[model samples]
Every structure is written in C-alpha cells, then in structure tokens.
Target: MCRPTAPRRGYDYRALIMKLSYQLVEQSWPLAKEFRISRGAKTQANVLLLALSDGEHVAWGESVPYARYGETLTSVSQQIERIMPLLSSQTSGEQLNQMMPAGAARNLVDCALWDLRAKKANASVATLLGLTPASTVITAQTLSIDTKERMAAEARTIGNAQLIKIKLDEHDIIEKMEQIHLAAPQSQFIIDANEAWSFETLIQVLPALAKLNVALIEQPLPSNNDTDLATLSSPIPICADESCHVSADLAKLKGKYQAINIKLDKAGGLTEAVKLMQAATEQGFIIMTGCMVGTSLAMAPAYLLSGASSFVDLDGPLLIAKDRDNGFTFADGQMQPHSSAFWGGENNQTNVELARLFTS
Candidate 1:
C-alpha cells in the first residue's frame, strides 16, 4: 500500500520547479453500465482534468462538473483558464480557495497544487498533509435505480459486499429494495433519494428502510426544503448530499443531518475536504466520502479523504471501462489506493532540463 520516496534521479532538486503553467482537458469516459438516479440516467462520465505543470513535473487533478451546481465541463474549464493567470509559485491553496468559490473549478486547482507541490518536494501527498498512508479503503458500490428483477440481479452479482448504496425515487417504494435486500442479504445499504422524496414519501419509506437495515438515507428532501428534517425522527441516520458543501454548510446542517457526504469535487478539493471533514466531525456529523462518475484520477485524490470518513463511496473507477496507469484496484469490495505513478505517489519526477526548456 506504500513505497519509499524515489530519488530525484538525474534531476536537480532546486530545478524541479521552473515556473508554473496549467491547462484543462474535458474528458468523456463511458460508464460500464447505465447509472440512473432520481435526477436522470447517464451512460458516460464527462469530466474536466486540470494539469498544472512546472514543465517536467506534471500534476493532475480531476473534477466532474455537476449540472446540479450550475457547472458543466465548459464552465469549469473556463473558470480554470480564467484563474490561471492569477496562479503562480506564489499562489497558495488558501489563496486559491478564496479566488474561486467552493465547487468543481476550485477543486481542480487546489488538488493540482497539492500534487505539484508533492512532486516538487519528492514526497507523498499524505506526508505533505500530515496524514499517514492508508492500507486499503472500503468503497460503497452503487446500485442505480431499476426494476425489482434488475436490481436483485445486479445485487447478486455484486455478491456480499460490505456496503452498497441504493438510488431510490418516489416510485416502487418498498418492492425493489426488498428484492435487493433479499438478493444481497449480507450487504449494508444506504438510500440515496437525490431530493426526490416528499414529506409523505419520507415518512412512508423510513420504516421499510429500517426494516431493510438501511444504514442511512441521503438527501431525501431538496436542500431548500430540508428544514423539517430537524424535527423528524427515523430509525436510520439521515445524511445530506445536495444540502452540504463546504465548511460553511456545517452550521446549517448541524441539526438537520446526522451525516454529511463530502465529495472533493463538491467541497472544492482535498484542501477544503479535510477542513470540511474536521468541521463536520466537530459539529457531530459523521462523514461519508463520495464521488461523481469519473476515472481513477478522480478516485485517487478522493482516496485520501476516505481515510477519515465513516462511509466511503469512491467507487467511480469501478463503474468505468478502464482507468489511467496503475489506477486503484477494487476487489472483494476493498479499494487500494493508486501508486505514486498515478498522481502524487512517492518518487514521482520528470526531466528538470525538459521542464526548464518549457519554462524558457
């Protein structure tokens, strides 16, 4: 799960950082299967990848621009391009956090900075962040909305995984879930309604959700109308997805949600994600690390956040066709983080002379 820092290898330590430059790529990778939610269905993950390089030392960060947040690949890409001139060796994560709002654009820049810095320092990002390396992560595989037979069939295929999240809506209520539960009898379930349920559906589903041993319910009501959650009681814990974002959300989500799902894309990046997780814990909210559908580049950074969370849903790579080199490995429901080669792994380096040439 870990490796020693690789030597500079024919590179001058002082020359690793020549000057800073960045670019963004809009990438679309097809999902392994149809992924449906209360919002809709999608067959591909359209993502934006930001590459910040001081020439040879390239650092990458990925973000999935969510339409729910008024962001698309184009908008986020433009945001990064707009902010590029404002960044340099002088810029800091704190400064970037302020320059951009907490969303996809800022997320890309923040993580790219982390990776670049780690590469320059010739160390792991975990060491830079004052965190220990993690052995393995247990990610929550998703069961998208489907018919009873379809869901049950899929559940059985996943086998007796430790955790599986069910995407539910106001339709079919108990029937599909009951079938799924029967199919994956050994799995723990989390219900993600995606703001589809009403006050009536909320009340109606709680008992069956409890009976099915659903561990949590995620965003059953819309963010704006979730005030009622403060008063309602349910057997299973209620988590906030759409309702929670940065640390600022901790104040409002305190009484309304028992858990908060933190996506690095949504919370900005690992810089803000760590802060949000700390703040969420301080405010008595159990944390769940989640993701949008993307490749291993997205999941690799998110794997850092999973170390401290109660529930982890960084299964984005598992839903895709393939991944970047040495991507995370998911087997027996456990996920091992990617090697340093993929992102900010130990001994990551490039030709300082080539980087110097680019800077020149």
Candidate 2:
C-alpha cells in the first residue's frame, strides 16, 4: 500500500501536510429556452465539473462534453477517473498536457489545476496569471437556427446586444438573415453557419451574406472541405471555429481564416487557449473567444481571454436556466468577471452547493 512520507528536520510542515486531490461530477442544467446550431438542438446543458482541493482550499472548473466532438458525459467522466491518481500540486500544466489528450477530459483537469494553483499562491487565478480583472466584457448573444419568425423573435429579444451571433443553415439561405437583419438592424452580426454550407452554398450565398452588414462569418464551410476558403474573396471577415484548435493549426488557417474562434473547451483549457490566441494574433488573425453550453465555471477562465480578443462569445451561462449562485453577470449583453468568491477565491459555502450538484 502507498503511504505518506514525513517531513525532514527544518522542512516546512505546510508542504508535507498538504494533499492535492480532485473530484469529477456530471452535471446538467436546463436551457432557458431552446438553443440549436447546424449539428442539432439541445434542451439542457450537460456538463462535467472538476473540483480540485489542496487540503486547505477548493477550486472548480467545468467542461461540456460536446457531442459534436464525439464526447458524452459518461466518456468524459471515465477519462477523468483514469487520471485521478496522478493529480497533485506537483503535477505541472505541461505534465497534464502530456498525460491527457486535448479534449473535454484534458480541459476539465487543466482548468481545475489552474484554480488550485491560484489558491496555493493566495491570489486570484487572473492575478496569478498576471491578467487584469475585467470590469466588463462585451459578449455575443446568440440566435439559434430556427424558423424565420422564431429566429426574428430571438434576434429582437437581443436587439440591445452589441454583437449577435446568428446560427445559420444552408436551407434558409436569405430568409433567416433577411428577417433577423430587419429585426435588429442596429446590432452587428456574426453569421455562423457552423459547417452547414457546401462549396456551392458558399459561392451562392457569400454575396448576400456580405451585403447583410455582417461583422463576421464563422465556419461557413465544413471543416474538412474549407481548405479552399483562401481562393474566395469576402467583404466580411471569415472566422475559423471548427478548423482551428491549438496553436499548431495556425499554419493551415493562416490565409484561409481571417479570424479564429478560441473556445477553452475546444482548445482543452485556458493554458493552450492562451497560446492559441497569441499565435493567432501574431499571424494577424482576428481573435474571438467562444464557449460551449456550460455554466460560469467554464466561461470564467475564457473571460480572461476576452481582453486579447476582438470579439467575445462567452455567453453559455446566459443561455442556461439556472447558473451557480454568484456566477458571472451578463446584463444588457455586457459581461462582468465573476467575483473572487465565484471560482478560485475565498468562499465558505460555494463548495457545499457545488457538492450538492453531484448529489442532486
């Protein structure tokens, strides 16, 4: 059996007494309303939370096991369980990166480690990482793929949002854009096809989509078929959501994608996401930080990326029915970073509620 070793003479007792541990839980939250994209629709946001403890303080991180990426809640939880014994304060981010493949499971553990390290250093995660706490972040409000009327109604609801991300499919063509544009003429739009368009659709609709005063078009072509985007010209910028993952993807996307959507979930966590942003920015690609449908715990780390990005799409918590108490605030589409008590900072009872999420 394994055993704990005692500290040597004059050794700091705190170092020897402290233990690092983690717990993984499956959680689901109902959507405030329907949210759909090119892939499908979801009524609830299924998520996995990784809670890390340092025998003194606890911190949390959350990840959505995106079905679009072939991940489900059960698969994500089992992946976390496999690496439980290896989690420790001594395990560096580099070590974690080497231990797990980049996906939902790595994202969960990597973020939890960041939170725990902030606690160990007695600083907020943002502070520990040398980032300013944002007073407010402008986040995109999404209008899911739907009938013209429903899409229009949803667009109208977020008429005051500075940026509205409109999910599109190949079928609607001009109908949905016409309605949503007419409904919220004042708001800038991100026309996100989410890989629903074909080469012909891209050719046929680029002109009309350009005329809609769209600020950006995201992943209009399927990830596997978008290699030729560089050959086409566009008035509005085209962003890469599915095509770009880690920093290594930049070479393939250099001339093809004008912008890259950096989501913590997709990049595996903030550690790699930060490297992705720096790499994308260096290559002159516009940066947009996005999110999967998760709670504030997932979006919080991504919020730190907002300062370095031109467009911020961290609105997952906004679409969910009930977020954690004291989660990040989104009012009038303007985001405020979560309080220290929300994630890595001091809080007495938040962990109790977080624990209950696993039980109830």
TM-score, per-candidate, Cα-based: 0.91, 0.90
Query: Relative to the true structure, how large is the alpha-carbon lDDT of every model?
Result: 0.81, 0.79
For residues 304-348, could you state the per-residue lDDT of candidate 2 as single tens digits?
A: 887788899988888888787777888879998776766766333
User: Model 1, stretches more than 4 Å misplaced?
Assistant: 1-18, 350-360
- Residue pairs that clash (backbone atoms under 3 angstroms), model 2: none
In model 2, which range of ten residues has the least summed lDDT? 1-10
For each of the candidates, the C-alpha root-mean-square deviation to the true structure, in angstroms, is 6.7, 7.3
lDDT of 2 at 39: 88
Query: Per-residue error at 335 for model 1, in Å?
Result: 0.4
Alpha-carbon shift of residue 228 in model 1 (angstroms): 0.7
TM-score of 1: 0.91
